[model samples]
Target: MPREISLCDIKGLVGSELGVSAWFTVDQSMVDSFADATNDHQFIHVDPERAAAETSYGGTIAHGFLTLSLLSAMNFDCLPRVREQQMGINYGFEKVRFMTPVKTGSRVRGRFTMAEARFRGPSMVMTTYAVTVEIENERKPALTARWMTLIQFDPKDRPSET
Candidate 1:
């Protein structure tokens, strides 16, 4: 479960492992959808038969971006939730590494640790998390990234347009 903490408390939570997310299965449909969305229809990602006969993985695999996109779901499951949070948005990734291919029909989960958190304004908190996407039953993780989220404490506390 996600931890409930105030915006003021985020500074103290840096370097702490928040929690692990529930496993999410990546099926062929998901891979196909991702391929359609990204216009990447590589044989290794969308063609199961050719993948089985030609590739060492022996099956279709999900795109690295597809796996990376699951970060939002993972954060909801096992990260700190700021109390009185009005809204939140992804800031961007500082770093990303696709370590292993995630084969279709495999399950993956994320491990999250607070990397840094700071107050950007009176009602805005900027938090960064070191996230590892682990493949079920696999020795190496599928991907790792530095994920950032901008948490807004109030609806009107947004950046001014100059």
Candidate 2:
């Protein structure tokens, strides 16, 4: 089930584990599609045989950015939602480190920790999540990032300051 909470209460969650998302498969087809979409046809990402012979990774690997992009879908499953919110949008990333290659056919999931949360305005909340994209059963994670999001709350739900 989805985690539900009031936007006003989110600030209290800083420094706590938010949640972990469900595992997602990173198949070669998806890798090829991402390559087509982004035009990042690097051999390691789109060419299997050549990648196997050329790189240490052994076979085609998912692009680093592809793993990064999956964070959004993972967030949908595990991130908390405001009771009266319009929507949340990507604010930016503080940092991102690709520590391991996610080979094609690997499964990945994101573990999220609430890094920080604060009121941006009367009805806007800004939150940062320390996220790790883990490759299934791998000692090293695919990537780690500090991602920020802007949540727009309904004006009626805004808390009044004392």
Pick by TM-score: which candidate is best? 2
Global lDDT of each model?
A: 0.87, 0.90
List, in order, the clash count of every candidate structure: 0, 0
**Cα error, candidate 2, residue 80 (Å):** 2.2
Instruction: Tell me the tens digit of each residue's lDDT in model 2 across 35-145.
Output: 999999999998899999999989999999999999999999887777888988899999999999999999999999999887876778888999999999899999999
* Predicted model with the maximum lDDT: 2
Q: Mind giving the per-residue lDDT tens digits that candidate 1 earns over 1-162?
A: 347876556676799888899999999999999899999999999999999999999888999999999888988888767776888989999999999999999999999989998777667778899999999999999999999988887746433430
Residue 59 error, candidate 1, Å: 1.0
Kindly provide the TM-score of model 1 when superposed on the true structure, using C-alpha atoms.
0.91
Candidate 1 residue pairs in backbone clash? none
